[model samples]
Structure formats: C-alpha cells, structure tokens
Target: MDNNYLIIRIDEQQNIELHYFWPSSMKIKYNYPTCITIHFDNLSSCFSLVSLCYCFNILSTSHKLYIGVEVFKAYLSVKFSQSYIQE
Candidate 1:
C-alpha cells in the first residue's frame, strides 16, 4: 500500500506551509510512520547562512535535515561581468 506523505515548505517570510499528499490506495502503516519532506525554497534569497543554521538548530529536535543549494548558470553569468578591465 502507498504511504501518505506531507510536504512542508518554508517561504521567504519564514512562514510554515503544509501540504498533504495521500494516494487513493494509501493506508496508514502503524509500523512505518508517515514521512515528512521539507523544501526550503528560495532560502538563500530570504535567509543568510548563519540564520539558516540557527533555524536548523531549532528544527533539529524533531528530525534530521539536510540542505542542498542549486545555482543557475545564467545567474552566475550575470553575476560575473563580461567586460574585463585590468586595474
């Protein structure tokens, strides 16, 4: 039987949003507890590394969390100017 899942997203404003996903044939397994997945969307834009660490510290009690950062090539190109000026 499929397992029910919860998706939690932390917004730019540090608001907690919850989403529930349950399949039609899903059944709650007492032996296997429901799993929760957290997605920190636009976290870098909202919180600095230090703040993110602090946030994680508070959340560490309930579950173990891992963070992954994804950067776009376009963003990198824009951040690095094409014009070369030697000082």
Candidate 2:
C-alpha cells in the first residue's frame, strides 16, 4: 500500500473531485479528460490519478470509505495504459 492519501472535495460546478498528492516522477501533464495528474512532491509510485472515483465505485456499491491497495494498483495500471495510448 502507498503511504499516500487523497483529498475529496466539490468544485464550484458541483463536481466531486479527488485530489492526490503524487510524487514528481509520477506526475505527468496529459490530455486525459475527467482527470488531471500532477506532481505534489517526491514520494510513492508512478501512476494516474484519473477516474479514481469511478474506480472506487467499481469496488464499493455502498460507497465505502476506503479501497484495497491491490485493487487500486490494478485499476491504475489499466487506466494509465489507456491514457498512455491516447497520449
């Protein structure tokens, strides 16, 4: 599991946004919609923070407060691969 966490908030447009503090190496400026990945500092693995809420929803129907590490990792790999191809 990563020693990182996300901050969930709502934007002025009433959209639920998930903000992640990603390491510099993990951050990338991509043309992916619905998600924007950025660098916060030097820490953790390299992956996309896109569609995180969608990924979370797939694992929890009851809207659980947390997600499993392996599940999150797997989801990120798939998402990153898709975004990579698009970019």
Query: Which candidate ranks first by lDDT, i.e. highest?
Result: 2
The alpha-carbon deviation from the true structure for residue 70 of candidate 1, after best TM-score superposition, in angstroms, is: 22
Tens-digit lDDT track of model 1 for 14-77: 3333343444464545333323222334434432442344323343322322222212222232
In order of appearance, the predictions have TM-scores of: 0.26, 0.29
On TM-score, the candidate that comes out on top is 2
Alpha carbon lDDT at 55, candidate 1: 27
**What would the per-residue lDDT of candidate 2 be over residues 52-71, giving only the tens digit for each residue?**
44433343333333523433
Error of 2 at 48 (Å): 12
lDDT of 2: 0.36
Error (Å) of candidate 1 at residue 9 is 1.3
Whole-model lDDT for model 1 versus the true structure?
0.33
- lDDT of each model, Cα atoms only? 0.33, 0.36
